[model samples]
Target chain A: MQADQSALQCNACGGLCYFSPERSALECLSCGECYDLGQPDDYLARDEFAHRPDVAEPEDNITPAQRTHQCQNCGGEVLFTGPALSAHCPYCNGPVVLVSGDAGYRTMALIPFRVDAAFAKRLAQKWAASRVACPAGLADVVAQGDVAGLYAPFWTFDSDEVVQYWANFVKPGGKAIRISSTKGQMKIAFDDMLMPASPHVTPLIRDGILHDFDPRDLKPYRAGYLAGFAAERHHQTVAEGIAANSADKDLLIRNHIKYKIDRTGVHGIRYLTDTSGIHYRRILLPVWILHYSYGGHAYKIAVSGIDGRTFGERPFARRRLALYSAAISACVIALGMAIGAAAAF
Target chain B: MLAETSPLFAAAALFGLSTYFGLIPIHKLIQMHEARHELRQGSASRLRRAGGWVVVALWLLTVMWCAVFIGDWWASGDYQAASERAWQRIGILAKLAASAGGVR
Candidate 1:
């Protein structure tokens, strides 16, 4: 059952962005700016996208899990081959039939998976080991679903720009702390800033599971990729991506510019501008996403197919936690005795 | 002979204190397991989902803040400054810790 759903509502401009894989951009249906797929040059917080599929297309001739169907919901393309599986369409950030698509999914620049399920399990176990306040049935939480592995499409952007920024410098003006008016500038060149272009890209909780794509790793879109599994389309757009990236590039350039200015001991700056160029590539990275609900919380964990980098939360073990806490406490008390003995010295 | 072991003792004492106080949170988390089991039968609530993250984030960042500042206090030579800052830190910690008891 395909449903129409979208999560992006631009608070700045009462607008909605649809991910267009054709251009690998988040096109603001309202505005024409293409937000490239992929993360900006310096992103700190993990982001999550609700992948939607083409549920708005009223023609229901395409069978579920049998053909690559356009969603009636978000108008994104996807492979819907199984009844038991559903995924976010990357183009519209909605649920879609994820089977196989032939409508032109260009499989190029693939990064093969380096991390395997064993590592994913290990990393997940380790991560669960850390979330102590996590529920007691941690093992069950990790066991809740079949982890799906797929190569998600990403659009990478590179750019050069002339950026100007204003910053404050804390200077030692006669020992009394004085904040100085600081202006700075720099030339920033961005390379390989990745954005998710595939409709229904994986969320941020997945980490370290990227594969190094080689030419040999690419495979054309085949229905078999969805025969036993599900597939998703990208919902993020190049326009939204570029806007975010542009802001980021501007900030980074300003930071470097500020550093350059600060190093010169000049507390003030001038009409700072950046001269920069941009380049990009389309890539498909390997990821294994396990989505399940436990304790009423929807938990999604990503395991890197390359470096075993993991992200997300799950239930915690009560008995194990108790034992650990007691052990740690006992160890601390024992050490406290040593401190007492030393204080005598 | 004991002087050689003094540092170890001091480290252990602090570790124990930290561990013990932290047990309150650990216990609460474990107790939360029963609630999760009960929740299985009911529909998942987005409120609870959001609350879980909110609580976790708050506690995590605060603990990190405490650990960093407290570590700084121990590591720095200015014990007076550290001690004074410790009071300021504890004041902030107390406000946060107090807020922890009353989450939906």
Candidate 2:
């Protein structure tokens, strides 16, 4: 595949432009002009079904770091140099998407950043301040931290599932409990089950900040939306994503079966699941990451760019916790002594 | 009366209460640290696990010590005294209730 490149430049001043979340358009850095990208194409064309055979398999020998693209505006060649698929040209400062030899998979859709960087930092500070066990000045330290906005890769899967199960339950009779076996089949349709496609975002951070993203807001993939922001392609394959999605589906199926049975005495559950009509789309999700250090230990906090929700690690205040424990102990002892004196009287 | 008045009983109660209150926050802190470590390293550190177990062992020892003391007090016939003291408190509460009823 050849490299697909587009240079986002301001028409008025011919300066570099970036996507501004507040304006929902490309904003030039030099003259502060906003260019409206016209309506996005329909997102349906990006969905690739597993049963389809016409789609070409990803190339095995294309190295991401070695790939390079020529800037359309300056004719300057820019090396990817990293796992990132989108970056600004150093020479001309034009935003570019280097799509050549990107393992055959392309980002089909993206959820643009709704919460800006300043708001994201405030969210992180509020989250840190709310932790009761955190150090006294942790929020102040977090306020000074720099937050970087990046579009992370993710996969959304849709499938139809048929689950068959057998279970035993106890039926209470007039005088005794009788055990009986039951068997049944259930059909479930799962839509847009999201899975992270980048290893840079750890599972803990992913699970912590992930919330329901509105499918209606998914705009068709456009390079202008990624202007002035860092973006990465999927390092994980569709097959690997499917395997992870299967584990999640199995847990969901078990919960559904348990809910359907509605018996606490049920035991020895056995089940089989058959899945079909599997469809997937590679998409980009926005996130803001803030890295900071406290007491010589470094920590990072992630904020969802769509909703500004924050989650991360912070250091505990040992002296304050010891004081709280001492106070509680004293109160417990005093209450006990008072009760004893009243009883003696 | 003897159980309530015994210094050993008071000491045991204080020790149990202090240990319970003191170790709970530390245990929670260690657990949070372990979770962060696992998030970074993909597995829990042995030292953190040992710290958690040490907290558990301390709590268990406190519970066992309190249990043994109570068992000894019961075997020494202090329960009878304790029961009498409880009844005395109940009598006082009943008298107070009767006086309040009369005033009403």
Assess the local accuracy of residue A211 in candidate 1 as a C-alpha lDDT between 0 and 100. Answer: 30
RMSD of each: 16.5, 11.6
lDDT of 2 by residue, B17-47 (tens): 6645675755465555545533322111222
Give candidate 2's fnat, 2 decimals.
0.06
lDDT of each: 0.46, 0.62
lDDT of 1 by residue, A247-315 (tens): 434434544564565432333434456343444444456565665567666666666654566655455
Q: What are the DockQ scores of the candidates, in order?
A: 0.07, 0.07
Q: What is each model's TM-score for chain A?
A: 0.53, 0.72
Candidate 1 lDDT, B1-104, residue by residue in tens: 42233333544554555555555555555445433432222212212332343444344444444444434434553335544654665555545544443332
Q: Write the residue-wise lDDT of candidate 2 on A1-345 in tens digits.
A: 122233566778877677888898888888999987657555553555463224567533333432545456554443342223444443333455554544435567888888888899999998888776578989999998767677777787788889899987666434344567888999888777666775455554555565556666787777677765665656556677776555545656766676677764566778998877778777888888786788988677888888786777778787766666655555544454445544443
Task: Fill in the DockQ of model 2.
Answer: 0.07
